[model samples]
Target: MKWLLACIAPVLLAAWILFLSAHGPASWVLLPGILIGIACAAGLSFLRSFSPALRALSLTLYLLPLGLLSTYRASAFSVSKDFELGALPLASAPSEMSIAQLPTGVTYRSAAFGYRGGSLFEPRVFSMTAILIKHPKGDLLIDAGFGRDIAQHLATLPLPFQLLTRYTLNKTAREQLQSSGYDLTRLRAIILTHSHWDHISGAADFPEVPVWIPPAERSFVQGEDVTTATARSIKSLHIEEYRFDARPYLGFAESHDVYGDGAVVIVPAPGHTPGSVIVFVTLADHKRYAFIGDLAWQLEGVTEQEERPLTQRIADFEPRLVREHLAHMAAISARYPELTLVVAHDPRSFASIPKWP
Candidate 1:
């Protein structure tokens, strides 16, 4: 144990410094990667009973980014077979108002102001998009895009935060909604799949509307879970009590039909966040779309069966859960080839999708 601690001190220190610089001293999100670093440092100082040769080998861990990438690519997370679940319970009644009933199977209005992130050579566009769902009863928005004054707000954050995850927006959701002449009052609620910074940042614009959050996600902001703690940047949470019934779709065994209309179902696939969800929108045209929230930044990640490297602590909390979720998504995609798997941040899919009126 002493040798192991000594060996990886470089990795831990590097991770700790980076996390501290990005999040600052007071951020509780620092618990995961930073705690081990402090513990290891204390161990080295107090114990000092390890071989120098083992330490050298562990210090080389950072030098081998290829090895790190390979380990991430070699996903070893397994789903629990013992966990039994049933298919979604029978709908109380057929949904009277489904996408099929709409003019062209629901109008999906996406206020997308995307940015090209990652590397300059292989930059992938990530859409900071807010989707407005129009139903007869009321209007609902999913995942608020960058809100008004986003630039000013971001400018207030740390320099490392801005540089590491550089966000460039073309338009804010509030700007888009206003320019499009959409009525804000009609927006009865905002459905948040998780409480990640990007997902909830723009929610500040909808103070009047109730924000629907899953049970686990509600606890995340309340600082209950250390492993998956969300930065309490946004507040005024109005959690909606919805039931997640047992149901199977492409082998996934639990889902909640939000409106009791089998068409729009919320599948709980927690990994990116404790309460992350996959929103399924099945239209009458036989086109089924799964709006997977940060399950992967792009659909290719699922189709290729890969995840982002471990060094990324800003978005993901559990690598094991992410690996298992990706495997399930891959299984579903392979089993049902016709269905379109939409990634929340994939700019390609966002650009191609039609807008609602």
Candidate 2:
């Protein structure tokens, strides 16, 4: 029994940390839980050096936290229930309001890393794709994926993150646009979902083009946050900070209607980052899409309402806020089945959009 408890304590503690990392209100809350879990596991192991009765009682106490963590991890969010979002907003999308996807690169990850209650054995391909939204006013590029300096950008990340992340680069957004003879003048601004390194890496390639971002995200880029370290490293980025008006749209409290045509609307969905946003684009065919940047890594996060597991602590500025927005987006998805929720990394989510030449 002593030997059994000694070997299992460390294993159970590791599992507990992974299972409960993002379950608390803030990311900081995870540290206490981890420290306590480690202490408890160590205490149990130490107890095993004494009487058999004491060892049994300590083992029981240690198992309690792991059991609790397992139960919490398995629990579902409120996204399971139906939500009312009233009628879809009226949109007068121009016939020329077109959209296409630029396949930049891909990163491989386990399904379990993306969300709670996912299969550990299943490998998922996460696309580093950029979106091109063309309008008569000016075309907008959303989330520049995989730049020429991707290697350098990646190196800026922590060593552990670099070791875990395995990616393949296909084409940078700039190369695709230039190769296709796309007129640079028509491209007005590059609107970012957030200023994360992966999403903003290709922005450096388009030095002349202004990168449109919300005020919050702009601060994130300029601030001393370690997460935005890569973004700050890029010297050529021209940021145009935009603000949201008091107008409400589709359950969101604030919205910025670009082009004043209701064809392109942006809403603050901060959780992934202080400046993270969801872009709603309505094409001429009346087809609508919501580009939810890193809100959930996969379609299942919206369809099934599963939040990120341990990655939320590293990926999200506020995990609780992320969960809240995920629930909201899930509700929105349930109300409008036709609306395409394009998750940033989920390659399958970009199926509807035509590929760039």
Candidate 3:
């Protein structure tokens, strides 16, 4: 009876929290968590020395410390961040062509809590963004975002990840572009910030288009998966080797001008993924935008240098590198608040900004 009580309490608590933190935060989160917790408790109870108090205390220590530490760590991270407007250095320009920013489709809505640890426990709606760069030479799409069949991608995901992404797909990138009256055929190529499913799922919509991938991130997907199928079908993937140069600027050593013109440039911002990069778009109006690809899920993560919590980090390609990169990004943003840093999946940040010229 004592062991049974111990098992029940932890199962209920774990399930409740897991369910709430998921993207959809559905009641479905309860079942998996409860089952896992029960299995764990059963294994521990095999010990003859196990008692109710001991079991409860063990679970308490494990669960309580993780949450408390996450909150405390986020607070400490926020405290470490600060920047000045005058300290940002501007480098020499390479071209004078004007570019336009156009975003397609609705941002795929998600939650701010467990999906992104930087937002604390708040359950605010977030987005998976898809942006278009209209250049004189050709237009480029950054982060393909969601598609009509986003559920298929989510279903193929492993374990905790599959359970985490439970949000609805508002529309596909292609649907957004066509509805917005943009010429989809004119799209020169698709630029993937990284090969994450949400960002690449919609690539299937534009099969004939050329795709550009970062040198560092080309191997993000290791095994045979849906991402591979999408990538393999691309018309061509050029390293754009000549454009990729090892020059120090914008707190990064490597940068590339998309069109051999200074209108659009890709900069190394590794950490979120080893190959993750950011796009620096300087419009004809002189306004500059940095499209950060999952570097920080929320802008607050940049301001506070708070990463996506410990548990979330476990699933990341490289969490330590991610934290270091987050710190660097926050420092850059701090020094130049005027340099607009657009997060890929943050709807609030994307809302105030206009899409396409």
Best by lDDT: 2
lDDT score, residue 210, model 3? 63
lDDT (10s digit) by residue, model 2, range 116-168: 76664456788899999999999999999999999999898777667667788
Best by TM-score: 2
230-338, model 3: which lDDT tens digit per residue? Answer: 4443333333322468855566667787666466778776666667777877665567777887777667667656666545454456666666667776767766666
Ranking the candidates on TM-score from highest down gives 2, 3, 1
Clashing pairs in 1: 87-246, 87-247, 87-248, 88-247
Deviation from native of the Cα of residue 229 in model 3, angstroms: 9.4
Residue ranges of candidate 1 with Cα displaced over 4 Å: 1-120, 149-159, 224-231, 312-314
TM-score of decoy 1: 0.68
TM of each candidate vs. truth:
0.68, 0.83, 0.76
